[model samples]
Target: MKREPSLRERKKLATRAALSRAAWSLMVERGLDAATPEAIAAEVNVSPRTFRNYFASREEAILYSLAQTGPGLLDALRARPVEEPPWDSLTQVLPAFAAAFADQRHIIGSLLRVVDEDPSMRAQHLVTYERIDRQLAELIAERIGAEVRRDLTPRLLAAAAAAVLQTSIEMWARGDRDLALPDLVREGLVEVRAGLPAGAAVRVSSPSPAG
Candidate 1:
């Protein structure tokens, strides 16, 4: 069984999460240049050195909440009954994961735009998901009776799962408010499980030629 976090450990995690949120909020409100370690630390009532102890860079600090997404879901996946289909288990576990994004829903669009505008942030974002992808691959391999490194299936499944989560989040963050994030995630999972066939032709409107 996994060990429960001590009160001290919980406090440290809370501090780290606070720092990450402060960094992101500063970046959104004042731009990246304004979200310095000193500023972020000040927002969290911590010293700059304490911030450094938690995160190595401003980018890492800003993206810290993202780094926790996979592990929690992986734990849920592991606890699922062994007889459940791997794909079904993957799909069913997403609503719980989607709920974690509720706190960010308001600022998610700004967060996406900020990340898109900065190359370093964009790179760090990819790196975060890549790490999740690798860990998820290992879990999927165990579920499917495949080797993590040697079997391509596990890696592919992991990538697809990650893509579903990423795409769902992006769409929910930037698209209509009518569709809830969990519902969006469930829809994406359904499409992915159906092999993402291009079932219907998409209609497009094109600009008229300049006179």
Candidate 2:
């Protein structure tokens, strides 16, 4: 049996979600520059202080809405059954992720547009990417039983994979080009794999280096 979220936890999640929704809605209606934290707090029926408790700034409130998707990706990776290859697990989960993106197409498209137009938001976007890349590297290290380093092979692959996903999502958000997002994601992964040096494989060892 699984435990559900406690009331406090649920309320906290709801408050954050409300803030995110309110921020995006306001940004879409008005421009991103016009969606002040005070305005968003009023829109969500929360005090400005409560809004600050949930988010550090208006930009964080908006970016949090999109960065919240990262946990879903981690959950998808966790849901894969034992004995599945890392690549195969990733491939299987890509469709579900794409579906989620499709569901939020309008909000995501608007967010991307805001990022393009605002320098602060663009910096925030880069920070989000760096966070995701670090998470991906950790996941890859766990899967491959390899030491992860800034310049190590597995870490580089993880960074490349994360980049591919980011690029694909950017392309998808650019316009409705009749191409499926999952197809684009798969193509991105294919390109990532193709770019890796030939015969790259994880090597397992029994002993740790002496301290």
Candidate 3:
């Protein structure tokens, strides 16, 4: 029942996928500085300008590579039975996303290292999450219908779910210790569903402190 992409659309998707894969592969093997945008485009037989058209920067390309799984996660979550609890639907589908990351953890670990060392790249990573937040909000809206705008529940649920899953994946990618990332992600989702810890306090970072 789904429509297949036309030739042109399929070609565009192929080019985008190639660029994303090339960016991650080169950056993982050679580090960010060596995997310049020009180099990545060359890998795909495209010009630097063409590369720029696909991605604003190397960081965006890297994040886009990882985000390949994001759409699948949303799709799976959306397909869950409507009678399922909202958080339950997310918890059920999130492990698949986590598993996708596990298959590519090597490049992801390298990407995380680059992000840690570059403020601008890290900012781009945050920006990428904003897109994810919006997409997840849309899915939440579909599940909850009217309450999505009338109340803040769906928005809050999306935020909480994002916080848990992202935090778990980031920690796992650090490679500081032995851990199963999918298991950790599942655990995080469970905890978020139950609410924050006994004494937890969230601090919002900003350019200036409130007087």
lDDT values of the candidates? Answer: 0.88, 0.78, 0.81
lDDT of 2 by residue, 82-128 (tens): 57877777777766687667766666787888898899889988888
Flag clash pairs in model 2: none
How close to the true structure is residue 145 of candidate 3, measured as C-alpha lDDT?
78
Which candidate achieves the best TM-score against the true structure?
A: 3
TM-score of 1: 0.85
Question: Who wins the lDDT comparison?
Answer: 1
Relative to the true structure, candidate 2 has a C-alpha RMSD (angstroms) of 9.2
Best first by TM-score, ranked? 3, 1, 2
Which stretches of candidate 3 lie above 4 Å from their native place? 147-150, 198-211
Q: Estimate each model's TM-score.
A: 0.85, 0.82, 0.86
- Report the alpha-carbon TM-score of model 3 versus the true structure: 0.86
List model 1 lDDT by residue over 61-109, tens digit each. Answer: 9888888877898999998998898888988898678978866776878
Give RMSD to native, each candidate.
Answer: 5.4, 9.2, 5.3
Please report how far candidate 3 places residue 165 from its true position, in Å: 0.8
